[model samples]
Target: MQGSFCDNIVRSSTKDAMPDSLGNYLIPTSYSRIVARELGLQERELPRLLEGTGLPPHVLLAGDESRISGQQQLQVMTNARRISNDPAFGLRLGSQLTPRSHGPIGYLALSSPDLLTALKSLRDFLPIRIPFAQVDLHEQGQSMACDLTILLPAPTTQLRMLVECFALVIQSLVESFLGRELREASIHFEYDRPAYGDRYEKYIHSELHFAQPASRVVLPAHLLTEANPEGDANSYAAARDMCAALLEQVPVTALSMTDRVKRFLLAQPAGSVNEENVARSLYISRRTLARRLQAEGSSYRRIREDMMAEMAAVQLRQGQLSVESIAVLLGYHDSANFRRAFRRWYGCSPQSFRDGVKPE
Candidate 1:
């Protein structure tokens, strides 16, 4: 009843770069399932894949969806990387992902008339498959560069695997589209060459470059115009529409630290939300909470101040609560201090701001 605006913000953006523990599963279970199969986990051994994520075994086994959290999927990948003997686990995982495994996005790509159209679908809807991953297509002389970036935070090992897996997945799709291996394409990785660098040369037919500013692939510009022999106009239209709908549906699994903090804070009961409370709720130390927020150009105090101001405005605008009551709701211990803060924020008294009366 106190946080009307906060309630609406939480409800509307539950899936937007925020934690979704109580909402419908936003992350597709495909990646987790793949890790299970890759590990050759027997029915009883499946728990190894789900170690710290608090997800049940059936969730991964139960078809493609029945969704899981991003943390759950990341946990499984972490387990797989630790368990697998192969140092190139990410590349190996990428090679194993079939087009069918990509779901509607794969269907859209396979059905696209030309490579450019297919790549465009990736650029526009990669988030549908991997919420934190984004692809930007650009022209670099005779080559088209598809720059890939992962925006969300995760464990260093898990993050590295996700990047390698996604880069290879995209490369595999490009090869699938051409119906041939790419001898001239070059892949630029954001990270330095790994200990098992030879595995990349062995698996990736493309010319490989590492230690670059970002992860990207450079290919002959003419390849984008080449027709897909398996292209189907009707299927492409249907799958493209489906990708659009799916992307619209979940709002993407946002692993952004700031967004997660904001959503969690807004959803908590008014007086119970604060820096200590947030750090505990988010499973991070106070120092970590402060550091992550600072990286995003925000601090816990800054976020709380902004939210309090907005809450004050909303309550005042509704005229449902007196200025004193609104101040209490926004965590102010005294109305006089609240009035001073409000005046500083709006350059006028709260009531006048609420009444839309400007300072003369």
Candidate 2:
């Protein structure tokens, strides 16, 4: 019922990028406890964060329960980085979070040739870690860019500051892993600079932007192909195999029909989520799909509306497109209908929603 990075991390077209279950992708609770102790944080804080997010503390220890809110997880990640001074703490924590047999994110890092590739791999699979943020990759003339645009639950003004801090930490982590001074790039925050910006320069070693359009880290295009001195090909292959094996061991029963339906819908384009289309894709008749929905305490109409509401809210808040245009994109007949629907779903007009969003 709460927000989760897992909910939005898997790009609709790329379910394969994620492991079959939530448990397969999380950091172990033991690791979280250890990290908390190391950082001088109360062990209870970790559990509290999970609990606040409506998740059980046990989920942190076992890869079996596999549900985490992006917001709550951010608190843990930020705490780790602040305490350890290890920028790659996320990746390191990741290595222990997943099944030990699978090597966590360590395998993914090893397979990369250069820091660029490693960063790319991180972006692709980042949903497994940080799901609420948009990991964007863009290429200008000779430069490449990477940014995480954070989307918080509506009405959280502090979400911008929190997201900005996390973005800086991510940039710091990438540079720390390579042992290179990320000289070519700039770390831009959508919010204004805090007094902490000076300390940031020691770790980031690049221009830092405050009050920018989006929070981002830009890189040189040539750096992507550069070979990573520490990279290992064999370990990467082994890790992949381990992940696949672990995935095979997890029973399908761990997931609900709603999760299955959601996964299927994630694989489809936005407009193709109708009952008939979903039924056809599932190789079932419309009546069968309806019956199953009834059994599950949900209906096709409910799920579709939920998806649209989520999509509409996120796009309206984060993206720069206009209301009318967004309406068209969401398959609405016109702006008026979109306005009415948005009012019903959110209790406010789209413009008001946009105006209320502070930059992160």
Per-model CA lDDT versus the true structure: 0.68, 0.54
Models 1 onward score TM values of: 0.60, 0.48
Cα error, residue 73 of model 2, in Å, equals: 4.0
Q: After superposition, how far is residue 71 of candidate 1 from its true place, in Å?
A: 2.3
Q: lDDT: which candidate is best?
A: 1
- 192-279: candidate 2 lDDT, tens digit per residue: 6664555555545678788888777777777667675644454334324323333333344455445455544443334545777566
Task: For candidate 1, write residues 161-199 as lDDT tens digits.
Answer: 877887787777788877888787988888888888988
Off by over 4 Å in 2: 1-38, 42-51, 62-65, 71-106, 154-177, 246-360
The C-alpha RMSD of each candidate to the native structure, in angstroms, is: 19.1, 20.2
**Global CA lDDT computed for model 1:** 0.68
